[model samples]
Target: MSEIQNKSVALVTQIEGALADVSPSDRAQSFLERSLDLYFALGGPPEAAAKLVTQARSRAQLRVESAVANVVIELAAASHLSDIDMIQAAYNRLDVELKAERSKK
Candidate 1:
């Protein structure tokens, strides 16, 4: 089993075989980045967010790559997952966000 699969099955079995691709934060951040990119592709917050996405992408990839170098890199394989992972991450993020919002309420 791949690292992502293992993580999903072990941690959130419900999302197993579902979250094939996507880091919750990365997906959320990417969504923000894309929206910003559309709003101000040339410059402004969108451009800034785009840069952040790039850097974060590199950082995320590097972290996984580096860790894999140190140990085993079965999970995620340092590759960007798929839309399902993104959707799963989004749903998970939404859940967390809702919980936080509810707690505040």
Candidate 2:
């Protein structure tokens, strides 16, 4: 990869690692903070850091959303409840998982 591409990947990987240990409620702020810090640390221009962080954040959000949606679908199918109930159950399970994740931090 080119130098910029390598730095971008490193920034994303660092953010992902930071996010993994943080509560869901804190992810947005954490992502922003870590992204900027990494970008500067990598000798990126201050003017372009915001744009880079935005792109990285979008990619990260999409991955996280996709993963959550897949889990919800799997949970709903395994739950064997009515449509409405299944949705609610899936969300509830997700909430529980979030709580567990938070407690770990």
Candidate 3:
């Protein structure tokens, strides 16, 4: 990975590790909210930290979507299904399932 990508991944991983130590009982705050709090606590500039987090989140989201698309393509090829409409429907179904799983605690 490039330096920026490596740094972003490291920062996100550090934030996630710290978040894991937070009390699970406190479920009121969202992850970004908590992550921002941690960033400020660690002496990072709020504006810069927010921008970094936003960029990292977007990259992570794209990676997930790409992975989903690859899986859909692989499955279609394995099943010998080459119809465009059917592949699109499969992708849509997988996207919905991914969203549903993400919504769960």
The per-model lDDT (C-alpha) reads 0.48, 0.57, 0.54
Error of 1 at 58 (Å): 31
Candidate rank order under TM-score = 2, 3, 1
Candidate 2 wrong stretches, greater than 4 Å: 1-23, 53-61, 65-105
Writing each residue's lDDT as its tens digit, candidate 1 over 1-105 gives 764445434444243335558466645564455556434633446346567767866753556447545433322232133223543564575567556655754
Model 3 scores worst on lDDT over the 10 consecutive residues at 4-13
User: What is the TM-score of each predicted model, taking all chains together?
Assistant: 0.26, 0.31, 0.28
Candidate 3: misplaced stretches above 4 Å?
1-29, 62-105
| Steric clash count of candidate 3 | 0
Task: Please say which candidate is ahead in TM-score: 1 or 2.
Answer: 2
Residue pairs of candidate 3 with colliding backbone atoms: none
How well does candidate 1 score on lDDT at residue 22? 46
Per-residue lDDT of candidate 3, residues 1-105 (tens digit): 655445444444444544455564453366447546645655668669767957866864556458557645754564454344644554565556556555763
Candidate 2 per-residue lDDT over residues 1-105, each given as its tens digit: 655445444444543554356566665686558546645654669888668757866874566678657655754654553344654544565556556655766
Q: Cα deviation in Å at residue 95, candidate 3?
A: 39
RMSD of 2: 17.6
lDDT winner between candidates 1 and 3: 3
**Structure candidate 1, residue pairs in collision:** 3-74, 3-75, 4-75, 21-81, 21-82
